[model samples]
Target: MTVESPAGPSTGTSTGRRWHVLGAWLLADALALTGTRLAAVALPWLALTTTGSPTAAGVVAFAELAPLVVAKVLSGPAIDHLGARRVAVGCDAASASTVAAIPALHHLDALSFPALLVLVAATGALRGPADAARHSLVPVLAESTRQPMERVTGLASTVERTSSLVGAALAAGLVALVGAADALAVNAAGLALAAVVLGLGARSVGRGVPADDDPHSYLVRLRAGWQFLRRDPVILALTVMIAFTNLLDVAFTAVLLPVWAVETGSGVGAVGLLLAVMAATSVVGSLVAAAWADRMPRFAVYVVAFVVCGLPRFAVLAWSDVTSAPVVVMAVAGLASGFLNPVVGAVFFERIPRHLVGRVGAMSTAVAWGLMPFGGLVGSALLALLDLRAALLVAGVLYLVTTLAPVVDRRFRAMDRVPVEVS
Candidate 1:
């Protein structure tokens, strides 16, 4: 299906060539995400098992996510200045070096807790910019390939979910076999490979910087992006809603679920199993969203997806003693979760100018992810204060209420309007 390019003009690349370019970007993204996913599981597990303290695990998680959010907020100008492909390559290289050090130090018996935190922090800082760089390239890729933004977004989401499924399974096996610290080496390798892929494949893609050059101060440029986001009510609404949801999600994934697994005498392998099923179903959801998103009302699909994605998983985990029930609940949630990004992506790409995409996209995502660093710590503390069921119940109820805001509030219906192009 043909759709207007977010950039207002297509690159005129042949259909086959466009698909090839899109394919390369997708594969590189999958590899990069796989590496991060591996590190995600290994890092927290290392902290939890080695220190035997949930608080310590939360601290490690905070170290990573906090730096990442800061980096993402500040990296917009740098992406525009250095170019997306270049930034992606540099960031991945830096991540690989930092992540590899964890195992290297451990093998030398030189890995102190503080040193590990420093290394993980470095990785997080690199990850934020790298992720921004990759996301900034999405609109460009879709325009170049002449694909609909919704379908491209859906495809990208699918690739991410698929990689997470594979990456989680791989991480679980590696952790079980070679131990968590050693599993980090796989992350390092994946990052290195992703760097190589982008360097080679996206060499000819134009840098994301705008045509009108400005010598404005960094803060001024940053403000310009912020101003644009503030002016757009839809962007602001989505950002607020997502920030809340992401906070709950991180809390659940990073701490609560794992803690529950331990309490139930279910191994890390079971944790992996639950996550894998969710990711796999998410892939299906993304594909379906891609095929039919155009036919559905964006607002309706978005709200319904969030309704399914939220509440039930938490409720099931909290109340159900049966393992299979929670798994099924998560699977259903994942399926709904898959449709969300495509709608958001379509709107996001359509509204922002092609030139400002790097700066604006970075700022936007940083805002959405702003609260995530505290999620792990808060989740751990809640487990300490409240029983598991009560904590989950609180999360579930809060999620249901907050996630429904977009549906209940009249302002969110603006999401259905055609995007007004920013100058």
Candidate 2:
């Protein structure tokens, strides 16, 4: 099947090629996410193993994610102007190189704490734009294939989560077999392969903004994206709600859970097990959403998903002595979270015009990721200031408040309304 290019369909474009296009993009996305998950594991492992300090680990985490948020915020206009496909390839290549550097430096005995921080930060910075570029291609692929946008969105989310599961499993084995630095090398190779797959399979997407299409200053165009987000009630509500929840989730996954694993004698292996299980269950949820989510009221499904996905695991950890209970809670929570990404993706596409997808999407991502960089630091600090039970309790309560905000806010009710596709 020939896929249509963003500029226009070529003579070779055919409907039969739709599956091929979708498959290519999906493979690329999954691979990219897999590499990201590996890096997530490997980076922290490196810090913890080398420094033997949770504070150092938190600093490394902060260095990686903080630059990522800032870079994502700034990448919108550039993504639009440069073209999504181009940006995707460039970012992936850069990521591969940067990731490869870590293992190399370690092997050479030249890797310092500060240098590791800088390298991880570089990888994070590239990741934000690459993700935006990849996500921005979804609607284009859907339109060309004449597929339901929501289906594609659900499938994409599922693929990403599945990759996370696979990646986590890979990280654990690689770290155990060789070392954390070697696992990072594996991440680099995955990213490079992803870049190749995307380059070959999805050539027809991402036309990019022409030079003369919008001659406005970069900041002016950025303001335009911000304004669009501010005016859209449904998107606005979703953004705020997700942002708060993301921070809590990050804290749980990056700090609280790992600490729990160690404190309970469950070890790093248990942490990997929990993460993999949660991601696998999340994939199950995404599949269910793909099959039936469109038939339900999106807001209702979304709100319920939030309720299940948030706060419960923290509470479980705080109250239960048996590790098995937290696993069950996490699995159930993951199952509930499956419907979330598709709902958000569909709503976003329905409301934001294609021409503005890059910018608006970037702004939306920036907001969602805003607090994530500090999650590890905060979680560590909370642990230091309070006992494990108290820290978990505080996090659980905060999560509860954030998750409930949407149910109470009138603006979020707009999600119940039918979505219309923007031109």
Candidate 3:
């Protein structure tokens, strides 16, 4: 278990700890994601309860997410130049301070809406780079431990899902017991702890560009990342496809599902139950992927998982009246969805050169998530133009088409090839 650092065993420090780096990275990632999920719930709730205006709450959300996406797109070069470990530690520490300010200011009766907005926005901006840096660490950590990328990314995905489930529940309980402001303080504490864990344990990993490496200007490095993505058909296609699917997912979760619940007389509780079921099953799926995904064909698994996880839920919601049908569909879909991230993560790590991981990964992620903010708007528009059932049907068809891209396009065949750095 005594694995060498990227610089090899000559560094004279890799012989003592077994899996400490990977363990610390996972723990840090879990803590950070949990804090994020807590904020996702607490921030909007605080805005709504304090301002008593839904529009103000919406504005707060927009303020946070818009900057986050922009920052992710721009932070890639910084991550590559300064190193993932440094950037992640710095951003998380800054995020902790910024998040702590919200509760502190509110307790003193001095937290205005505008000030709250700025704080939330700062946390969001910091989060973008923090997240990208963490993602860039997976490949390095996997190599250091001599572990397969599928296993590492699958574990990461599982940690992500588990943290989200736990964090949302925790946020709700904390908000109910002590209010959103106090819940936010707990979030700040989690982030600060994550920073400490990562800074101390991951010192040898993600050490950034070497001094002897080419020192390209920031803009040139950024452009090089974009150009690489544009030339690589597989990653580019995956980016576009995932972006559209993300939009549809947001639409389904944010608008369609709730509207369906109301129209079907299932109530809000049923909506929560359905999502809970999906998330739980998805965790199980991630575990399976973590164990066996490396043995499976990446292309086939990716295609099948997307198909299962995408169109079926929409189809079930649009067409079925049986109470148990949607639940069953969600369980199946969640299980299938679990295999997705591991496969995609392995492909990206296998294909992208180590030097460009930060820039390429950041740009790809930013693009994939860029459509999410508009998802609710798109769903609302769909409902405006079509009936509920019809809108669901349309969304389902779109998802089906998007997921089938891999099967139709030959470029995705490269997913099955041996790992080779794209230079």
- In model 2, the runs with Cα more than 4 Å from the true position are 1-7, 10-12, 207-209, 320-322, 419-423
Models ranked on lDDT:
1, 2, 3
Candidate 3 Cα deviation (angstroms), residue 364: 1.3
How do the residues 1-423 of candidate 2 rate in per-residue lDDT, one tens digit apiece?
A: 222234345357777676787788899899889988877776776777777766676777789889888888888888777777889888998999999999899899999999999998999999999998888877777787776667889999899889888988887788878888888988898889989999988766644335535767999988888899888888988998888888877777777776776678776667677778788999999998887777878878888888888888899988876568878988998898888998889888778877788889988988989998988898888888998899999999999889888768988888767555533
C-alpha RMSD of candidate 3: 4.0
Q: Which scores higher on lDDT, 2 or 3?
A: 2
The regions of model 3 sitting more than 4 angstroms off are: 1-10, 15-18, 41-61, 102-117, 175-182, 206-209, 212-215, 255-273, 315-326, 383-393, 419-421
lDDT of 1 by residue, 273-337 (tens): 88888888999999998888867799999999999989998888887665789889889988999
lDDT at position 204, candidate 2: 64
TM-score of each: 0.95, 0.95, 0.86
User: On a 0 to 1 TM-score scale, where does candidate 1 land against the true structure?
Assistant: 0.95
Worst 10 residues of 2 by lDDT: 1-10
Q: Could you give me the TM-score of model 3 versus the true structure?
A: 0.86
In order, candidate lDDTs are 0.84, 0.82, 0.81
* Superior by TM-score: candidate 1 or candidate 3: 1
What is the total number of backbone clashes in candidate 3? 0
